[model samples]
Target: MHNITNGPKVIGTKQTLRALNKGIVETIYVAKDAQKQITLRAQELAQSQDVPIVFIDSMEELAKACHVEVKTATAALIKN
Candidate 1:
């Protein structure tokens, strides 16, 4: 969370999925309380691409950590 706050990051399910497919993201953060449909897909993609997925408690917690007002189901930390 701290790392993403200080660096490049893409938030939301669609954006994170694109980043994962493009292999631009080094790590992914998924909200544990997110919808199963969304989280499962993201997790599968991360595993297929060998990207690390860090699970956070909830969308509220994750969004707060990212300094965003809206809840975020997922986010990806992009490489430099």
Candidate 2:
């Protein structure tokens, strides 16, 4: 999605979770095939924070969409 480009973003699950927990994420992008254990908490946090979550087909697709060199399980676009 266009939102993934040219914005304050966190790539990978850990950073995404940290940003989500801190209430700084406006939206999160989760790989559709990501591990439930990893993405589940983040999804819950995002829902609680009223942030939107978008799902890509795969981790590789997510990373490619973000133009990153490595696969990313999740990512967040920061608030404000």
Candidate 3:
């Protein structure tokens, strides 16, 4: 599998949702302490789209994975 963890395709919640609707998202990562409603919505969206979801321990971890300083949530969209 491609290492999107440090690639240029990482996106935030809004963009992620848009990508999800387009069937471009492969997986989503949510911070453990993220808002319940947001996480739930993301889960529902991913489930409906058949995309995988992961919950990380912190925003810092998600940021690291996305190669950013900090990220509350993100989704790794399919490359091309």
lDDT of 2 by residue, 1-80 (tens): 65887788999989998888788898999999888998999999999888989989999988987889898889999977
C-alpha root-mean-square deviation, each candidate? 1.0, 1.1, 2.5
Q: Write the residue-wise lDDT of candidate 3 on 1-80 in tens digits.
A: 22557554655777777777777777777778767776677778899877878778877677777777756565564646
Cα-based TM-score, every candidate? 0.93, 0.92, 0.78
Query: Candidate 3: deviation at residue 5, Å?
Result: 1.1
State which candidate has the highest TM-score.
1
Clash number for model 2?
0
In angstroms, give how far residue 13 of model 1 lies from its true place: 0.5
TM-score of 3: 0.78
Q: Enumerate residue pairs that collide in model 1.
A: none
Off by over 4 Å in 2: none
Q: Which has the better TM-score: candidate 1, or candidate 2?
A: 1
Candidate 1, run of 10 with poorest lDDT: 1-10
**Which candidate do you rate higher for lDDT, 2 or 3?**
2
lDDT of each: 0.88, 0.89, 0.70
| Model 1 C-alpha lDDT per residue in residues 16-79, reported as the tens digit of each score | 9999888899889999999999888888999998899998999998888788999999998999
